[model samples]
Target: MKKTFKIPMSILMVFAIVFSALNLSVFAEEKESNDEYNFELVQKDDNIVIAKATHENGDELYATLDKATSEITLEAVEKPKGLLKFGDDKTTKYIVKAETIDPALDVVDVTIIDETTKSELRISPEYVQAQLPVLVPVVTWGGRALLLWLMEHALAMTIAGITAYVATDLISDIRKSNKNYWPAWIRNNNVYIGGDAFDTDYQAVGWVKTANSGEYNLWARTEAKAKEAANKAAGTNVWHQGKPTDGHYDHYHPAKPLVTDPWVVKLDNHLWY
Candidate 1:
């Protein structure tokens, strides 16, 4: 009999905690790396605190603190060019204000607007804690190991999945190109553009079926010519909107233009829109 390894609950808990911390650390690092604030506490004394602030993208914001009264004031020297998301959901836009003042010690006051509803929200460090998800360890069997493995190789898995999808799409395209083979008649029949000569109000109408189960793109010089061409091509004198009576040629159909020296279809053997 083969013995299966079952991870201990304590060890599983430890593994979960470690993985959670690593995941959180990575997310935090990414968020911090995207920090737009270049602001830092420069000087603090009994009377005042001064901080120089700049945006990562060159927009400037400055802050100052009054130590005696424990008041901090922040202001934007120049408005940030686009919208800025400060919270975790990243659905909020940081509103550019001329001034911001801290009401008490260890606290900074700021105004941010929700991007969707355009509602104003006042947020501080304390209220922002709820934005982070609480990491809880779930008990599992051998699957816990698989979870750890997947977490370790997430990037590789993602790349493999994308490559597979792209290869599938490429294969489909190749098969379609192979199936779009043109018949001998389509290859032989040359497009004739005669509408411009016969009448000023003439145009090319819909395609008519040919003798070889193929199709020929035809342009009519006038309404009478259009009716005549339809009758000759399909042995039917009826058109979609009946026979056009007015001299104005309203029944225009899409046609592919000739590409080669003999005005033939393109190499792909498909009609150009």
Candidate 2:
């Protein structure tokens, strides 16, 4: 009985050793596979960030970065084209362009250029935060004051003033009034285009006055009749009130001709205004 137990114990030990050896072999293979390729940033030129990777076969792969989407692409050797391929080594190059980059955010694009077939493998940016709703705060204090002053009797005027004050406060609270005079989205992105991008149905009159001339720059209203009037007067793409610069409002119309002044509008709000 003792001999039988010893024989089984020895067999168990041998099995354990064999399993450990197999695991070590697997780990070594994994390490060797990972060591087959290495990456390095090679150059940054204007809107392009160039990177190079060396494969085990001594073949070099090139990549370009698209800063906007944080995507990398394999660059063609000669032309500014992409999708470059070499031999069967299957090395990939990643390219990142500077234009697509947001420095405030650590956005990066990585691309794998297949050396054998000249194909690309792209990795997109992972958005960490969800987009927040944009709200434009319009203060109606002046209008309320005017309404209060228009009351004839002193008592009546006082009552109206109180009502106005309460109403204004309620409206302001609902609007989540911004003291800085800009929408939260614009503030977050530090964008100041002097334009209106808000849902007009909530307010009768919304305008941003220029500091210099004290004239309305952009205006929108909830009243369908008012919007229709403004749209008609300004054409379908009407400037209810002109921007300080002619092109300031140009970006508001995407379909407008390229020659249109201020041809582009920065889109701070994810929603189309």
Top-lDDT structure, candidate number: 1
Best by TM-score: 2
How well does candidate 1 match the true structure in TM-score terms? 0.21
The 10 consecutive residues of candidate 1 with the worst lDDT sum are 155-164
lDDT string, candidate 2, 1-273, tens digits:
355435687787777666544423224321212255555657654344555544443445454443233243453222111123223433323232222122223232333334455444332254211211111000011111111222111111111001111121122342343311211112122222221223442231233211111222222222233334233322333223324233222212111223576753322111112
TM-score of 2: 0.22
Cα-lDDT of candidate 2: 0.28
lDDT of 2 at 94: 29
lDDT of 1 at 263: 43
TM-score of each: 0.21, 0.22
lDDT scores of the candidates, listed in order: 0.30, 0.28
